[model samples]
Target: MGRMKSSNRKKIIGALGDPRIKPYLEASGGNEKDALALYRWSVELTASIQETLGVTEVLLRNSIDVQLRKWNNEQLGHSASWLLESPASPLRSMTKSKRKEALRRAEKSATCRSASHFRHGQAVTHDDVLAHTMFGMWKDILPNHSPGADPEKTENKNRMTLWEDAVKNAFPCAEDPEGEKTYWRVAHLHELRNRVSHMDSLLNVDVLDVTRDAFALVGSIDPVLANWLTGTSTVSAVYGKRPE
Candidate 1:
């Protein structure tokens, strides 16, 4: 067998960090070349996962955004500020403190870009509102009303207002039943999204499961979107190439 290069082995160790890459190296019987190969494979797999995840996030966010806008308009008219602050709106069901926090976040997100455009003497469009607002903020405003239930229910008479209504309209399916399951899945994906955005290592994660979950979430929203993502995805191909 060819000897492993010291410089290449050192580079792999440094790039992936000790705790993560150490076990693989030990399992390879100190075969630096084999360990380095594993490291490279992991990097490639992570990249593929990140790429697929980005597409899934965009689709999920857009689906939710469209539904929210439709529901809000139907329920309380189309005033953006009223949607965020009206006593009859979803934000009303939240505790006073949570409502305040949510409003602050919504206002901050809504204005940040428009403020920039105003300063630059540029026209800001309605698209800017959609672009600047984040998926996490939407998740935050729609808290789980029935925290304890069989499959977890989004319908609660006590909390019947805009939040529950919006969830019903947004998810509205047998796959997620009450929408709690969908909410939970999106929450999990959001956490994973954060890690990927921050450039954190996903070596310890089950990349296949993450990929499956992402596709499933998109599938739940729109099967056609999921199919499109699957056709373009490199996750499965990259995962197949992992070192044995």
Candidate 2:
């Protein structure tokens, strides 16, 4: 019994020791019957501490600001962002058939997702699906430049695609060792955001995996992302926002 107790403590500390806390931490002193509660406490406490420390913004924001050079200087992910955004990539200038196919898949995803919310009186529309899809594809370009030429400036970028706008409003950039993709800032996040916004909705594992991969893509472009995530840097330092 004593050996078992020691082993458990090791597990708890190990779980808590990582810069990213696991699903559970500091709940019931590790003896609670509710693992979910522990997980919730861990996430909540960490989020709280992050904001309280002011270290959260520093790491997430500054890191991305610093790595902006990598996107243009070093080709990250075979320049995946560039490739995807290029007129050559399927996203920017695919054949009509291919574009339709992508849209079809995205539509299905939106429909299925919205239907899941229908019991609560929510409705899905084609426009919603299209907006969600487009957002997922072009979300990374709002901060410094305005695209200068929004083909349809008459169309509201915000209301027309609120889902995309929200993510852009929140995660404007991905600070990492690799420079910013800049291309994907607002778009891809729209896909993930549309599934669940302004709530504590649990995502399906597959969708969770996809979002994680997207996060990974951001990291691949910058080596310093992990450090920034852990509060080692901030946008001020990244943008050279320090006093001389």
Candidate 3:
């Protein structure tokens, strides 16, 4: 493509907001045209990361869901969905509200999409509710440190017990206790996912390192998925093309 004229660069910068474009400008040594080029590269890099993040999110959620299902069913002594409200369930005190909210949204959507006008019945399924849950919901459920909480605190005990009974098994390859390594890696990618969704700058982000963490997180659940993600990811290629 031809060089972006200065007027066009100014227009682009104005539309994108100076704050958002400032990092690119600095990276390009204050050259407006170069800054625009870097901005375009950032867009491409964000797209690449978003694509991989999509796959990673699904893999992580589904893997964790599977274990939760098994554990929940075992606790209930029957095959039952794990996401429903259960006073005896670990989610009762922790993620119950989130799950309820997500399911409510899913049902609301189903009502809109359905042919029925009555509010009595909707076709929303467990999978629909699961699909509507945010990435943070999955991340928050993982075992994590609570700095000042007593070991017997409800949150602490729930997280530890959940990890032992279910979450850790989600990652067949994770070797760390309580899936600490897996949790942090998922947290890393979750942050990246948020940045991409919010249209934030990737200028200071270690894109390659983040992508590696993404691949490793998927691999932790299943090496086959990791291989697939690595083979298909284009973030590395896009990163290499960043403007000088």
lDDT of 3 by residue, 1-244 (tens): 8876788879888999988889888888888888888888889899999999998888988998888888877887888776655634676667888888888998888777645556446567779888888998887888775345465777877888889888889888878786678767878888899999987889889979989998888888889999999999999999998876
Candidate closer to the true structure by TM-score (higher is better), 2 or 3: 3
lDDT of 1 by residue, 1-244 (tens): 6776798668758887887777668767877778778767867776777789778767765766666566656666554532344444444454345435545664565455554564443333344444545556555544453356322334343233444566545554326544566667667777777766665556567767777777777887778877898899898898788777
Q: What stretches of model 2 exceed 4 Å from their correct place?
A: 1-22, 25-29, 33-35, 41-98, 105-129, 132-135, 139-244
Cα-based RMSD of the predictions, in order? Answer: 5.4, 16.9, 3.0
What number of clashing residue pairs does each candidate have, in the order they appear?
Answer: 0, 24, 0
Judge candidate 1 against the unseen true structure and give its global Cα lDDT, from 0 to 1: 0.62
TM-score against truth, every candidate: 0.68, 0.24, 0.90
Residue 39 shift from truth in candidate 2, angstroms: 2.4
Worst 10 residues of 3 by lDDT: 113-122
Colliding residue pairs in candidate 3: none
Q: Which sections of candidate 3 miss by over 4 Å?
A: 1-3, 114-122, 146-152
lDDT of 2 by residue, 1-244 (tens): 3344556755765665543233233333444334434444434433333232233223333333233223322433443222213322222332234335445665566556644565334443433333333332333323222346453453333322322323223333344211234433323344444533322222122432433344444454343553444353232232232111
**Which structure is stronger by TM-score: 1 or 3?**
3
The TM-score-based order of candidates, best leading, equals 3, 1, 2
Error of 1 at 230 (Å): 1.5
